[model samples]
Target chain A: MKNEIKIFSPATVANVACGFDVLGFCLDTIGDEMVIRKTEENGIKITKIEGYDLPFEAEKNVAGVSALAMYNALQPDCGFEIEIYKKIKPGSGIGSSSASAAGSVFGMNELLGKPLNNTELTNFAMKGEALASKCEHADNLAPAIFGGFTLVKSACPLKVLELPTPPDLFATLIHPQIEVKTSESRAILPKEIPLENAITQWANVGSLVHGLHTSDYNLIKESLTDVVIEPYRKQLIPHFDDVKSAVLEAGALGCAISGSGPSIFALSKSEATAKAVQLSMQNAYSKSNIQFETYVSKINTQGIKTL
Target chain B: MKNEIKIFSPATVANVACGFDVLGFCLDTIGDEMVIRKTEENGIKITKIEGYDLPFEAEKNVAGVSALAMYNALQPDCGFEIEIYKKIKPGSGIGSSSASAAGSVFGMNELLGKPLNNTELTNFAMKGEALASKCEHADNLAPAIFGGFTLVKSACPLKVLELPTPPDLFATLIHPQIEVKTSESRAILPKEIPLENAITQWANVGSLVHGLHTSDYNLIKESLTDVVIEPYRKQLIPHFDDVKSAVLEAGALGCAISGSGPSIFALSKSEATAKAVQLSMQNAYSKSNIQFETYVSKINTQGIKTL
Candidate 1:
């Protein structure tokens, strides 16, 4: 058995337009890297944190917390140490914390001879997310751990389902250099939504799942509309409407706030259109004097893999 | 061009458990039939009605209204007369009105040399639904017209998407001899839904769509749970909980009130299980001294076809 392992977990876009808190997809370009090694001690330790300022305490850091959860579940006498290199920035609304959390558990699972399945790893990773966001949600963590498009059927038992993705599908992500606290963004949403809007939202979600399975571009385009959450969450993001309109005009199939806000993403049929969407979105934000970074990528078919 | 055509439109189960007003599916056993023949006159006439008492006027009856809509759209310089044979009774919550409405448009489309596509046909059929329920909704009408599992992406422009169905999937429908007014059932639901409940509902809807496409029975079972609509509508149906429990215990994958109520449907993996569910549900209702009819069928892949 391997005593040490290195793994990478991709970033995820949660909500996927109309499927708020239920749908997410992995990204190929941006993610977090974790190196996990078995140690003589009986607990988890965080040896290093790079690329971003994050907690080093095993219990406090997301990656370390996830690793510890996996270790405890295995009940192995040996301890583990985790080193995280974060590429996905926190509060970008692109599942930064989830990559760290999922990567840690995934790496530990490999080092321990694969004691847990992907769903169980996702469950442990969700605990890490709970530590960060004050709630346990698998929308981001499931995709980060399982790859591709993922649907969280239920969070209680943590049923994660992998969905089909068209081979030609591409994504454009624009991360503005701003922070929209996930908790604050969530708090801004209404506790109750009009029953009609709820119906529309579920309709879009069902259509989106159907579109992904069938690789129907027109269906995806029609299903990307958000009538419930986006109308409320977009207020926290700067230039939300202008950037969305620009991306749509630039031939993007759909655009929406990535998760909570401060970051936006668009899906396209080809890499060329995705690049054009990136340029259009960047220009829109620049016109408003907002600094942002853009990444264009194909949908990540491999969620977490060995490095 | 053929001057006369006959078509059959399948019965539909809307809501599909968790996807209220968004998802629906067709059944093989129950439906409505219409015969349309072009006439020298300039409009539409409902010359006959059978199996149920419905308005004979072109504008008042669902079938006649739908046929008139198709006639107006074609402007074929000819009138059409329709004869309706309804097997799916109205107020059964099994999409009786939708069957007549969809059947009328489908038959007229055939008589007019296919002037309109399925979406356009669905639009006219929705007008028929509006005549009965006073609201233009197509959850039932789309599936009745299109066949198989369907997702209504949007209602304004009438975007309908057909989803894949598993080959072995069977349905058991136990329609008690009772009437649950669609309008009143809808009115009983709250105008606003809790945001948390909405999230659960959409998650289930997304999963159900994924399950049907991928043929994952467990996923379908998990996704059939309803936390938003059924809790409110079940009260209108007598012994709803007992019937549901009985069906589930009898090897059904999932069970719920069909459409708005008075009819209950269960999904199973095999024909035998479906029949078993039918018996269990019928027995449960019998104990309550309620009269009902039962049907066991494979999913109707052919939504509207000539007999």
Candidate 2:
């Protein structure tokens, strides 16, 4: 087994429209690179950080915390040092913290001769995710670890289902430089929802899953709806409706907030449509004064990859 | 075009566990038979009704109502005469009315040279379903019309999706001789549900659709759970908990009220397991003071079939 491993852990879009807290998909273009090395010492160390002013303390860093969670469980004979080159912005709502949390465990698992499954790795990554977000949901980390589209079926045992991705699916995302905390986005939600809206949401979720499995693009377009959360959460992001209408009018399959806020993502059937969707989003959000960055990515079938 | 048609319209188990008012599957061994013929008259006529005391008048009968809905729209230059031989019991919660409602549209479409597609047929059938249940829903009629498992993506526009059917899947259903009115069963549901519970319900719905597409029996088992509707509706079912426990112990995939209740349905992976489940349900519900019937049927792939 190799004593040192480097991996590319991609960002993810969680709470995928109708799926709410249970579904997410990985992105191909934007990610963070991490280097994990096994050392003779028995303690985790955060050796370096670049591109962002993240904490240097082992326990304070998501990568170190996640690596320590895995290391303490296996009691591997040697310690591990982690270096995070954070490319994803922390509050972009594109699962930056999740990338860091999942990348460390994925690389460590490889360096330790692959002792853990994706489900087990997700559990450890979720531990670090909880430290960053005050919640232990696998929706973000599961896709980062399992690749493609993943459904976090149950959180108790951390059952993450890997769903098939259509070859033609492409995603266009716009991350407006603003902070929308996950906790605040969650706090704005009502404690209860009407059962009628719940039924509609679940119907959308069911059809969306069907669309993914059969590669039915029309079905996917029809099912990418949210009657529960998005109605309220859209208030937090600037020009949410304008962006959504622009992408939809531009012939994108669907558009919704990426994760909790500020970052918005849309899915299209082809790269050309994705580019068109990106241009539309730029036109829609350019009216706002907030600075933004945009990207187009294919649905990442391999979650975390070795460099 | 054929002047007359004889057909078998299968009964369906709708609201499959977590998929309340959205998902349903047709059963092979249980259904209703109908004979439809083109008449020289200008209006639909209910010529015969046997095996059940249903209204013979065209406007009052489900079959006549559904056929008239289509006939009125098409003005097909002729009238239709329908004869019903009802085998499934009314108020059994096994889609008896939906069978009658869908059968007429399906048979009329064939006699009219298949002018309407399944989605259009489902809309005409909903006109009849509304008369029987005081609601315009396609949860039951869609599966009875389309065959196999179906998802009612939208009700107003009447989008009924034909989902893939895993070949080995079978169903065990118990129909106790008790009346649980569809309206009353729906009345018992809370208008507002906890957002947390709603999230769980949608997660299960999404995962169950995934399970059906992938044919993953374990995923199906984990997902056949209802956190929103069953808890209240089960009260109208006799020995619901006992039957569910017995079926699960007998290695069934999952169990829930067939539609609105007194009929409880359990899904199993194979016919043998379905039979075993039927026996278990019989044993579980035998202690009750009500007369009941039990059946084991494979999933019917073809909806309304010509005889």
Candidate 3:
């Protein structure tokens, strides 16, 4: 039997505009890669790390914690060591932690003879995210694990559903060189929201899901509106309104702060439009004098996979 | 062109479980029938009414107001007269008022040579619902006018999207003989909802839409949970908890208060299970010594069709 495996777990955009805390999708580009090998050690070990500052202890690092979670669940006869080559940056709000967490568990599961189903693997991966953010959220982890569009139906029992994505859909991600702690961004939101706004938000969520299923670009445009969280979170981003307007004017279907903040994403009907939207958003942020990286990609259909 | 037309507008179950004010679907068994004919008079008229106490004035009754709105919108050289045979009971939380309103407008639109599309017809029908409830909401009217599953993407510009429904899915509606005014039930709800609960609610809404499109029964069962409106509205419906439990145990995919309240609806994988759920829900309420009527139906695929 093969005793080692290498896997790639993609970056994810959570919230997806109107679907705050519930929706996410995987990006074709940008991710974390991990190589796992069976070892004679007593427990999980993080033998190596690259390209980012993260804890090395098996219990503290996201990758080590995730591999430990899987290892403890399986109680495999053989121990394992994981080496993570991180590319997705931390605190980017593009599911950097999730990529690491999912990559570890996914790689471990493959090396362990695939004992866990995707859902169970996702549950184990979420522990790593919880360790990082102090909250167990699958919006990012689910997409990283399952790929395409994902919805976290419930957090308590951990039900995640993979939604259909249109073939023509493309995403543009602009990661500004700044940091917005997920915990702080979440804390800044009001504990209570007006019922009216919630209704509008849910309406948009329903429409967005419908649009993805039917490949209706107009429906996607109409449903991408967010009334509750965006109104509050926009204050943390520079020129949020102008950038959103610029993208929309440049033929982007919709644009919103990715996950929590510091990264903005726009969905477009064509790759060309997505590229155009990337330039428009970048230009809007130019006056702010902040460094940013832009990526245009088709949605990643295959999430975490062994190579 | 024919000067007269008769149409049947199906009763709708709005706010299906977790989708408050945004989702709805047509029921095949219950509806309102309306006959609209071009008139020489200067204004609209409600010439006949049956099976319900409704106003005769053109601007006051749901049927009259709906026909008037359509007539005024078209400004056809001829006015219109409507006759309504109301079968769906008022205050039953089954889109009773919406049926009359949608039926009148639907019949008038056909009589006027189909000048209005389904979306435009829903808009005119919403005016009638607004006249009755004092607020314009298309949750009920959109489904009654369009058919199958429907989502009101936005109310301001009146964007309505018809969603796909699973073919094997069936609905069981048990309407207990009690009065719960839509306005009063709405007024009882808190103006603001906890953000946590709203997030949960929207997640379920997203999953519910996903389930319907993919025909995944487990997803449907998981997504039908309600946290925002049902807790407060269930107080108005007797044995609400027991009845919901009974239906679920009887193989219902999910169950919740249909529309505003006093009517409980359950979804099942088959017509047989739907019938069983209907009986179970009715029996749960039997101990309370309350009268009730039950309906088991396949989702009406063709909404507001001519007889």
For each model in turn, which proportion of the native inter-chain contacts is also found? 0.96, 0.87, 0.91
Candidate 1 lDDT by residue in tens digits, B1-307: 8888887778889989998888899999887787888899888888989998888888899888877777777788888888888889899988999998888788877876787889999998888899988989998988888889988878898888888888989999988898788888988999999999999999899889888888889889888988998889999999889989999999999999898988999999999999999889888988877788999988998798897
lDDT values of the candidates?
0.88, 0.91, 0.88
| DockQ (CA atoms), all models | 0.88, 0.88, 0.87
Which regions of candidate 2 deviate over 4 angstroms?
none
Ranking by DockQ: 1, 2, 3
Tens digits of lDDT, candidate 3, A181-290 = 77779889999999999999988888889888988888899889889999989888888899899999999999999999889999999999999998998899888888
lDDT of 2 by residue, B1-307 (tens): 7899999989999999898889999998899999999988888988888899999987888888888889999998888889999999888898999999999999889988898889999999999988899889899998998899999989988788888887889999999998898889988999999999998998999888888888889899999998889999999987899999999999999998899988999989998999999999999988889899999999998988899
At residue B108, candidate 3 shows an lDDT of 76
Measured with C-alpha atoms, the lDDT of residue B104 in candidate 2 is 92
Clashing pairs in 2: none
Worst 10 residues of 1 chain B by lDDT: B66-75
Task: Return the interface RMSD of the candidates, in order shown, one decimal each.
Answer: 0.8, 0.7, 0.7
TM-score of chain B of each: 0.98, 0.98, 0.97
Model 1, CA-based lDDT:
0.88
